[model samples]
Target: MLGLKQSDLASKAMITRSVLLGLEQPGRKHPDQLALFQLRDALIRDGLTFVDATEAAGEGVRWAKPSGKVWVDCLKDARAMLGYSLDELSEKSGVGRYVIARLEKTDRKRINEEAARRLRDVLFDNGVVILAEEADIGAGVRLRSRVRPAK
Candidate 1:
């Protein structure tokens, strides 16, 4: 989920790899509260919602369904927020210039979901998160304060 490996997740959360592995293990649970909080915060920032156990449902993670229109409206903003110009976005996302323009249009234009996903994945991988629209609140685009050190 979220197209991430365990090592990537651990790095994002700033948690040690062994600690995260222990937390995931069946019998070797790691009860580091601070690490748990860090991981939770990182996941939340990654466009996931955590559902607590209810009478009818067990605790689970979910990616909220973003409003398509909202996503379209903000595509350009997201690309720009990443400090990527149109050509840069095209290169990174492998979405054509025409498609990007069409998706950014206020009026409906034909563009498939796959193209959108390609663009979205680039933004996600680059630390931009598109927030899902909720009742009484409109959708939003947020830039994570992420700065990974050079390898």
Candidate 2:
């Protein structure tokens, strides 16, 4: 996986983080083809290759080549998909907001494992799919549906 901040990736992809966050929602409508291509190209430059489903595995993304640096944890992706602000997630999960932010940045040093578990549980309970490693697919997260009803 590549290690780029949302703002950085959005810049390279010619998209905004808000757009990237919207696209992450499961069951959301697709963006324009040009925007999609831009995002794909940006990710390709970051060493990801989009995979197509076959007999051995399902459609997903894979590293096109070895890359260094730890990527942001799935927590941030799931949180965005669920539309929960860090403060909201912290309150719901009973984890400190600071710690939640740290986890999102992949800065887990001195972080409590129990606190992280609690945070993950909150995300899972509210319709986020915490994907585990399967076949060659890496661990990731997705939303099953939006967490709250639309206004």
Candidate 3:
């Protein structure tokens, strides 16, 4: 989901690929807590979320939502958080201004993958990191360390 290879993830997590693979393999012993937490946090930083099983759904991985709110709000909040006006976001994302306007105004508007990908890339570039919902925590966006909130 994060489009990361084993080596890439291992490097990001500061762990050996073999150790990461061991953790993935069934029947193998779990890695040490520190190693596991390191890997988890690393993945989280890159927009991967681990979900526990609930009565309705089995345990699985979910990509962070592209934006913070459900639909229109998501786009607006993401843009606001990055201090990007619709025009700036449109320019940065290579998406048309009209499309972004429609996205922010229309409720439950569905966007094609390409457009979504464009916006997502722009958001990430500006430090708006989306996180998937967990058992008790809801999905949201977080700024990277270097990103300051807009005044």
Candidate 4:
């Protein structure tokens, strides 16, 4: 489901394939907290968000923010959450400043996948999590950490 091979995910999570398999199966004993943390980190690093179960809905995954406002607003909001300027984002993402400016200032939907990927990667790398709307969780942006470390 996370687009990762079991062996690759196990390696990334620093756990054995048997352990990962155990976690996947329903009847096995739950993994220790450290193993779970490792797995969570591996998934989160790839932009997979694990929303906790709420009264309204069971747990689920979100890839990006839900559609509504222009996607460019989402980009700008994420950049703002990371306290990065357009120029700074451009430098970090290797996306042109004009492209970013247009995204932020206009409602154009012509951005290529690679360009969008670059923008999203830079924001995610900076700890800005773009959450999609779940059954109850509304779409929004939040930082993984309130006090982010220097890049």
Who wins the TM-score comparison? 2
Displacement of the residue 83 alpha carbon in candidate 2, Å: 2.4
Q: Is candidate 1 or candidate 4 better by TM-score?
A: 1
TM-score of each: 0.49, 0.59, 0.45, 0.47
How does residue 133 of candidate 2 score in lDDT? 47
lDDT values for all models? 0.70, 0.69, 0.66, 0.68
How big is the positional error of residue 44 in model 1, measured in Å on the Cα after superposition? 25
Error of 4 at 95 (Å): 0.5
Best candidate (score: lDDT): 1
> What tens digits encode model 3's per-residue C-alpha lDDT throughout 62-87?
45544343423355656766679888
Each model's RMSD to truth, in Å? 12.6, 6.0, 14.9, 15.4
Q: For candidate 3, what is the TM-score?
A: 0.45
Ranking by lDDT: 1, 2, 4, 3
**Stretches of candidate 4 exceeding 4 Å from the true structure:** 1-67, 70-72, 135-137, 146-151
Per-residue lDDT tens digits of candidate 2, residues 40-144? 999888766665544533344545543332223567766875789999998899888988888877546655678768877888788665555455545555554
Candidate 2 lowest-lDDT run of ten: 63-72
Instruction: Give the 10-residue window scoring lowest on summed lDDT in candidate 1.
Output: 53-62
Order candidates by TM-score, high to low: 2, 1, 4, 3
Candidate 1: segments with Cα more than 4 A from true spot: 1-69, 145-151
